[model samples]
Target: MSVRELVVLGSASAVPTRTRNHNGYLLRWDGRGLLFDPGEGTQRQMAHAGVSAHDVDWICVTHFHGDHCLGVPGVVQRIARDGVAHPVDAAFPASGTEYWRRLRHAAVFRDTDVIRERPITGAAARLDTGDAPFTLTARRLSHPVEAYGYRLEEPDGVTMLRGELAARGIQGPLVRRLQQEGRVVAPDGRTVTREECSVPRPGQKVAFVMDTGLCDAVHELAAEVDLLVIESTFLAEDSALASEYGHLTAAQAGRVAADCGVRRLVLTHISERYGAEDEPRFAEQAAAAYSGDIVLVQDLDRVDVPPRRRAR
Candidate 1:
């Protein structure tokens, strides 16, 4: 019954278009909800997307840019107003501590004091999400500001083969015991091992690379990921502008996905200049490089993280 999907709240880059709102993304992994780069109007967008403040367990800000962190105040206040009982961890660049303080305390409200601050100061860091099945890591990204990208990796596990279990005449309680104990004694006095019936399941990986140009960290983060959600702020024709503004073009995003062996490439943070009619052009440009699934994301789009790869 676990659900893992990325809910796109908003997709605009520097400015909000008539149709597109500012940046906001929610990654729902099992029971944890990670809110990334919440920009202006994130609260309203979350409501529109049927997400509540109580659903957010962590808030990850890429940088202090207005389009990335402006919604912190409203989100924080909303969490307080709703009395979110659990502690919400907020991660951002350590250099932007002052900006975070201003945003967290922009207005006076009944503070629940449930928001915990964990600033990222190093080139790489791991976030401690207690009991979460995945490892969360952050890496520095190539941006004009002190920005970071995040990667989540699930641990490799074993998948029980029902056919193999049936062939061994194992059923009901015996199957559960075998799975829990890794081995179980059958009625015939023969020991059935989990390895005999289960195959290796390679963990699924998801990376979020926002507000960054091409860099070594970008490739490192995207490498071998099942899903890569990255910014495509411009097309190939506007490569110069993208480079100057510390953003990635659709072609560049595609190349990164291909080079890094990403299974699926999700291109978001689209600029307002590209109208609705021009959306397909972005996907076309990206498709030219990456052979995998390419998705040009829009507001409120939900992309599921594909299941783990099973052993052949």
Candidate 2:
């Protein structure tokens, strides 16, 4: 069975509090894992989340801020230390090439040669994931530093309708043949098309937006996605500070989710100033803007992507 969920390794912003860790998120899609914006304590946080270096197939860095990419050294070291057999790909802003190199070799550890660096530049760049089920792309976001958001799109597929299939007496290997060929010959020599027995299913989409102020790319990447994991570093009361630091408030994040038709919105990268008591305020402010489901993330929290929408 395939598992799909978001494992919140850490959700704190610039500073980690006693209850929250630094920024980190592991998106588990089917059998593959994509780790995003791993900060200082990601290595230990992964262990606590019951995930290992082997689970990480892709590392996406939104920016080089300490709260975003500080854990690269430890994560790279652990990937080498565990001798993970699969090749791990790392994507980040091309302008941060020097930072990427320094972090990869930050320490004098034996290199296992497992990581593949794919530096992203320009307004939008597609990362090559040869033969992967989904396509991954990065789009520039409006951050003080060079930053980018990530989006994943799966190809559209067809879902079999049991009622239609049974009505046509199609079953067993004939069902598979119908799916594979899009048409199957009936015993009466009639040509039955896949459309008669299946419904078109829209592909699943996910977006990761962090450390960005309001921008067109933010809306573009988030448009109609099933799940959007984004940074909400401040409450509405701190709108000025959020604007100065190029971060989003809970209300802004929620508005984006509502405007983009996001099904589930995950609010993370919470400021250190907010404590357990203030968590509810984030949800409340976001609720005031978006009617969709909103999740205020916590360390080690797992949120599953809601069921895929199918054509009626």
Q: Look at candidate 1 and tell me the lDDT of residue 274.
A: 83
CA deviation > 4 Å runs, candidate 2? none
Misplaced by over 4 Å in model 1 are none
**lDDT (Cα) of model 2:** 0.93
Q: Report how far off residue 152 is in candidate 2 (Å).
A: 1.4
TM-scores, all candidates, are 0.95, 0.97
Cα miss at 223, model 1 (Å)?
Answer: 1.8
Task: Record all residue pairs in model 1 with backbone atoms less than 3 Å apart, i.e. clashing.
Answer: none
The per-candidate count of clashes, in order, stands at: 0, 0
lDDT of 1 by residue, 1-312 (tens): 999999999999989998888999999998889999999999999999999999999999999999999999999999999999998999999999999999999998988788999999889999987788898899999899999999999988788899989888789999889988999887777889999999888889999999998999999899999999999999999999999999999999999999999998999999988888988988899989989999888899999987667675
Whole-model Cα lDDT of every candidate shown, in order? 0.92, 0.93
How many collisions between residues are there in candidate 2? 0
